[model samples]
Target: MTEQLEKLNRLPLRDDLRGLTPYGAPQLDVPILLNVNENTHGLPQEVQDAITASVQRAVSGLNRYPDREFTELRTRLAGYLGHGLGIENIWAGNGSNEVLQQILQAFGGPGRTAMSFPPTYSMYPLLASGTGTRYVTGDRAADFTLSAESAAEQVRAAAPNIVFLCTPNNPTGTALGLDVVEAVYEAGTASDAIVIVDEAYAEFSHAGTPSALELLPGRERLIVSRTMSKAFALAGARLGYLAAAPEVTDALRLVRLPYHLSAVTQATANAALAHADALLANVEDIKVQRDRIVAELTELGLQPAASDANFVFFGGVEDPKRIWQGLLEAGVLIRDVGIPGHLRVTAGTEAETTAFLTRLRELLGA
Candidate 1:
């Protein structure tokens, strides 16, 4: 394996990608999985049966090409969002990452730049690289918060063609306030940039926090991307969507591969949507677990960033990897997000949360 990898590296490769490592998080099988911010509680039994039936219906269509426009899926998704959106205002891909790539393909390229404020989602930079778009990242506060003034100032300086704001940000679970989004949009107007607010974890945010969808009325350049993969427990389904102006989705159509969403994918997602209430019944319980983690971690003398997402990012470790290894030895798996003193953990079931907290406290001798 080593020799083959070394030989492959010697072959011709893109100059930009020659030394870059692939995106990944540790995927270990353990007693508890809180690494990837996935919902451990699964779909309700009724939803599962509906989804199975739907996919079974779609199996016969395997001989035919899927819907070229994915019209039905788009319509159903739009209805689910319910912010005065229509089919023309929605787009879907294999995942939110792909939809993001399509956005870069349409608006960013060699001479253009895509800017983010990290540490946010790791994929933003990789997506830029894959699309040949220059990637740049601005700084956030020590607490991992991005203020309106800071966002505006950075946007002005970068003057990028694409701006990514990952709300309920990955790695750090902090969410950006709407003021920051508005500030960035106002500041970037002079640069003609498209501002993408990634809300993959929106559903898990604290109650009464308005969605970026509420701000879509007049902002033509604003894009809010969401996914069924996270809160919907549909990661295996691979359906990510975005909502924007009709023209924004219209532009995406020009760049997306024809019939990218398959019949099976469409049927499964549509069925899941029909049982959305049942599928989402676990959210409140997950929130309780997430809150418990934050409080317990703080009580242990570590600082956890105030999170609005499914996971919590905590600091105050002397050696992150050492602690990570300790947890792994106890059969728990969380993420070491490469931050100096921080680690991230997703909220699982109540028992899983208890197991994680117990093992972590034991590791720290607390």
Candidate 2:
């Protein structure tokens, strides 16, 4: 082997990722985009103009690096969250995915383990493996609801260094109750594990669902991560923030590269914040679309789980690939999850939803 190849082979690349390709969602242009859970709406003209104006005003400062601390953006985000946790307890990264990695780097590695439930976000295991930490799975029960008792038992047994829980979980589109979150946090406390709750879709959740921020007061190990990618309609900006104890935020700061946020990204994010109401209105529309999709799928004899997130997850058919292929060929795109016979369809514009439903009905011969 060449010198470089020999040196690369000597490093302990985690065996879990030996044959796995890097993670990514398909980005092909199609008639309808219901694959990646992106908000169907784009920034309003006013917001776009404001962002452009902001960028133009700061064009002179392009030569200088952005503030490493990102204080202004942090303050805006703090105000947006409207929780007790202030900017002092906030941290930002290139994306929430990076924030997840920073949590693992700070609390888990080598002999330490990161615990999570399966049929959840696919990134948890990937993040754990990248940090050279053991990824422990506490598979959810048959109904796709988490078994807190079983999960707590696993936390007690494995004693992982970090725990990741995704509320309004991806692919499954199931939101764990606050009670379940508290139970898991309490369990992690017993083991002194850092519990990171990924609430990327918190905006789409049903009314009355408590945010993890509510638990930040007494739970020092609880870290709640939010992303502008989903509800805020700023996925292109690549901004995510985590709120937790100041000490936990400090730990993440230790590893985050300086000036992770670019001038344009920060400017656009601030613009998005200025138009928060507009984004939220869009989210409300998505919720309505979500409900309609779930009902439609149920009518077709498919059992879609009750979802508060922007997507619907259903199972029952022995092979969903036919449905998936049918949609694909018809120029509609959606996500097929790991669970056998399960599929995830994200809510899009009204027109897109109508086309998807029409295609779906034809595929199922309804």
Candidate 3:
């Protein structure tokens, strides 16, 4: 065998990954894709024009490396964040995932803990492993609400260095209300742990739900992570950021790669920012479609969680995997989350939603 192959075989990988199945996002080429929570709409024509113009300006500087600081991009992002917080509080990465990893690297490692909730984003646990940090979880209540007391107990017991809370949580589509989040945040603070709120779906949240950013005052240990991937429809460009106090941003900057955000990505995100109104309009439409899908699922005898995000989680029927398989065969792909008796589906375009509903009704004999 080659020298590289010999060394690879001899080296022992992380102990936790032993026998753990590798993860790859599902591959489904269908007329309707409801598996991943992606906005079905592309950037508007006006936004595309802006991107083209920005790209032209950037092309002349191809010989130079991207700005190591991503200062211009940060300025645009700080502007996006508005006067509420300035550039001192912002950190960006290739994606929100990387930003999350940097948080772990900065504060978490062997002998330290990273706490999260179950049926939340799977990436949290994976990210923890990459930093050699212990991953601890508090299971949500049966109704999918965050158990503030239980979470508090875990914080005290684990004494974790970092705690991740997913707002309008993934896989279940349930929003942990601000009061509960505050309770958890308070509990976590008792241990002097950092609380990272993963608000990847905040744009689709129900009105009146307070954003974590709005609650960041005096919460110096808090990091509210946001992504342009979901609401801005820029997943392809890979931009995500965290808003926190200057100290936290400084620590994150220490571990993050120098040129993590590319000029192309920075430019694309700036273009997207200029069309915020159009993006919010699309988000509202998704929310409307999400509500309708939840209702339709209920009428078909499926109990869906009260979702404030753009996806719906419904199940309690026979064999969610079999149902998911049937839907896939019928060309409608939904996410079969590992959670038993539960499946998550993203709301697509109106026509796509209709097609999925029709096929689902036929499959379930509704």
Task: Give lDDT per model, in order.
Answer: 0.91, 0.86, 0.84
Model 1, C-alpha of 330: deviation from truth (Å):
1.2
Ordered list by lDDT, greatest first: 1, 2, 3
Residue 11 of model 3 has an lDDT of: 74
- For residue 343, give model 1's deviation from the true position in Å: 0.6
Ten contiguous residues with the weakest lDDT in model 2: 13-22
Q: lDDT for model 3, please.
A: 0.84
Please state every model's RMSD to the true fold in angstroms: 1.3, 2.7, 2.6
* C-alpha TM-score for every candidate: 0.97, 0.94, 0.94
Best by lDDT: 1
User: What is the lDDT, from 0 to 100, of the residue 95 in candidate 1?
Assistant: 84
Q: Candidate 1 local accuracy as lDDT?
A: 0.91
Tens-place lDDT per residue, model 2, 8-29, is 6678975665655568878778
